[model samples]
Target: MTLTKDYKVLSCDLDDTLLREDMTISKYDSRILRELQKLGVNVVLSSGRRAYDIENRFKQIGLEKDGAFIIGSCGCEIVKVDKMEPICTKVLSNDTINVVVDYAQKNNLNLGRNLFHYSIFISQFKEFYYSTTHLVYTCQNPYNLEHLRITNIQPLKVDYEAIRKMCLESPPTKLFITEDPIAVSSKILPEISKVLPLSSRALITKAYFCEVIPTDGGKGPALQWLCRNYIHCEMDEVVSIGDSANDVDMLEMSGLSFAPSNSFDVAKKAAKEVLNWSNMESAVGRMVNRVFFNGTFLMTDEEKADSKIE
Candidate 1:
């Protein structure tokens, strides 16, 4: 449906939609995003990464001041990018965490938790699940676990008992389960959700991940809350873009939903339209162009040439 009003909030996924193959936002993508914000658009960086991690990325790209309505942990946390003030947080209760941990332990699944300000990981093989966790928060999924080892984003390790204790002591914004998505979805998803109360939710974010969260959490519900309570705009005044199964709910709820050509077929199916260009080809810049320039997303030769990531 074409929105009668211009979208106020442009919620974009970080991993694939904005961050290209090298985990860097292209120059063209970066330029156009700030331009849109100048057009009175609030750029919402929605990701499964911790807020601090997301903020650090923005700082690296000099867009820390440009991104607003920072939503993290797959919508379990919402905070303003400028002051890092939290607007909302959904933590899984102790009872629910115990049940999920028991299941993960039995299946030898890798379990993790992201705090609002920090990260805590609980698993038998801490290093084994690094790339998978990185994918949910950063990209489609990293091809090299070795690359993650050299990076500084590793989560603080804690045992299963510690994970459970932390959940009881202080709830996690979201619970991250990294495994074969198909395996988890088919073999473990039903079991995970069956034990949780009606207030909880579980989702398979990618081919190798499952994000168990509060039922009230997820991009769709989070966006609604932000719109109704903070932005005070109608649902039709938001644009959302993403590239994975975790992005489905947000895309479905957006006024104008877009999926890059590289996006999963399932995610493309959920969007209002699909971009012909993939994320590698400045797809986000093109999408922003479409939003502003009457559906013709193009770049000048100079801008196109300047768009290449280092």
Candidate 2:
């Protein structure tokens, strides 16, 4: 059955949801999104990525020029693209940062491995930081670095002293930690939670990444804030697409939600529909066709027959 409900806002996650496996938005998908925006839909790029990273990469699609919004850092930041102005932001307090520092020093989960435990510092500067004992060094999450190559933005390395100074002088939007997936799940996750204040929260956004931000900040809350104050839309009128645990909040709140076939179980369970196609197969484009174009946009008979990925 064709969907009859009206949808005004299209909130989409970037990685493994709207973007292809190649870390780019396909031409077909980009065209569909542009068309949706032209039709007066408020297209929002909601992602766990930093706002700069999202804007730098997506500006090529011209969504910013069309008055789109960006909810970045998994919801710690919200920006209106056209004006390049922040609508809302949440930051980890200095006390919270101090606590995290102490925890990291006391619990050296990666001690003596000679391997870097990369972490990102999200703020005015897009910097990547890592630590060994009491000394902090510059590093990059190799996976994130691959994506940053698209933007040509260099990852800055800083010392532990620099991080401490920043925390005291100007708090950051959030702190990101990346390490071995097994260690992240087993050790880092629980220990970090215990050290953080009730006002601060840590969540595993990906298999090897844990992000710390203000307790009130998250994709769900950010979506709610935008709808209530700016977009003036109901949660039920929003269409959300995501593929990770971090997307669960926004997915559950949307009236129409989708997860790609390759999505994590949590995302699939949260979404109303799970697409047949994976990200590499133009999942976003297919979903756009099915929902907005009535399953006919750019669909050849052969493609339609092969729509379901085995």
What's the lDDT for all of these models? 0.72, 0.72
Q: For candidate 2, write residues 1-310 as lDDT tens digits.
A: 2333368888889888876655777666776687777777788889987676677656766664545778987898887765446779888887887877566546532211011234656788454332322212234456445434433444555644556565666676677666677877898989899889988988776776677889988887899899989889899989899998789999998889999999989899999999887887778877877777676567455544443333
* lDDT (10s digit) by residue, model 1, range 1-310: 1222377988888887887767777777777777676667777888876666677666665563634677878888887766666678888877778887887777666776653333335466221111223321222233224224323455555667777776788787677676665777687777887877777778776566677888778877888898888888876888888998778899999888999999988789999999987878888787777776555544667667766533
Q: Which ten residues in a row have the lowest lDDT in candidate 2?
A: 108-117
Q: After superposition, which runs of candidate 2 have C-alpha atoms over 4 Å from their true positions?
A: 1-5, 64-66, 109-152, 299-310
TM-score of 2: 0.81
In candidate 1, what residue range of length 10 has the lowest lDDT sum? 127-136
